[model samples]
Target: MKRTTFSLLVVDDDEDDRMIIDDAFLEIGYAGQVKKFMNGKMLFDYLEQIDPSFYPSLIVLDNTLPKMGAEDILTLLKESPAYQSIPVVVYTTSLSPSRQEKLLQKGVYACYQKGEVMEKVIELAKQLRELAESNSPKE
Candidate 1:
């Protein structure tokens, strides 16, 4: 099966989830890069350093990242022009309506529920592929 190329960045402190995403991508033959960051701050800092042209096609932000403050990151990204253009997707098990609203208000592309299993990770990769394809500029 042919797969769409997508550069995805996952922000979550959990090592297992990171590995799960890595494994799921490999299983589905997603050859594009999947960069993992332990927190929002690191991701923000890295994005600052790298050229915006190198931005990931999708960003998966886990709600549980500590110290880096997920909500704050969302708000900040929403305010910045360059960061605001990149699609942000919240990937966390929490399904609170308020949080979801907050993320939407901040302009998230979509949100997914994460859990102990790798099923969510695999599903997310599939969805992200669709997102990348849909958002691609027409020739």
Candidate 2:
């Protein structure tokens, strides 16, 4: 299999969750950068400051954030052509089918329930890796 280097942005308020995600990715041997933000506001601030070419290959967003929630961020991203192409995957602990449908309608790449087990997290990391690799620009 070909290896691709890409950047992933994670927006979640929970410190433990972020650390777990980082560990999971590391355990999976993902050869990429993972930039994490505490909330959507921080994410937007980073986005504004970075060059467009350096935008993250994927954004893993938690539905419940401190300042701005995932729904609001999704709206803003969809409205802006410059950031619309970046795929966003919503990771949340409580998501109803209706909520998932709504998120999908709003243009999220995928919505996954936050898992309790380490194996589940690793699986999510692997899935995210595949999604990021598929969306990454070809050389």
Q: Write out the backbone clash pairs for model 1.
A: none
Error of 2 at 18 (Å): 0.4
Best by TM-score: 2
Positional deviation of 37 in candidate 2, in angstroms?
0.4
Q: Count clashing residue pairs per candidate.
A: 0, 0
Q: Candidate 2 regions off by >4 Å?
A: 1-6
User: What lDDT score goes with residue 75 in model 2?
Assistant: 95
Compared with the true structure, what per-residue lDDT tens digits does model 2 show for residues 35-136?
888988888898998778777789999999866899999999989999999999999999989999999999998999898999999999999888887877
- Candidate 1, which ten residues in sequence have the lowest lDDT sum? 1-10
What global local distance difference test value does model 1 have? 0.75
Worst 10 residues of 2 by lDDT: 1-10
Tens digit of lDDT per residue, candidate 1, span 32-60?
56778898878888889876666676777
Best by lDDT: 2
Candidate 2: lDDT of 32? 52
Error of 1 at 81 (Å): 1.5
- lDDT (CA) per prediction: 0.75, 0.87
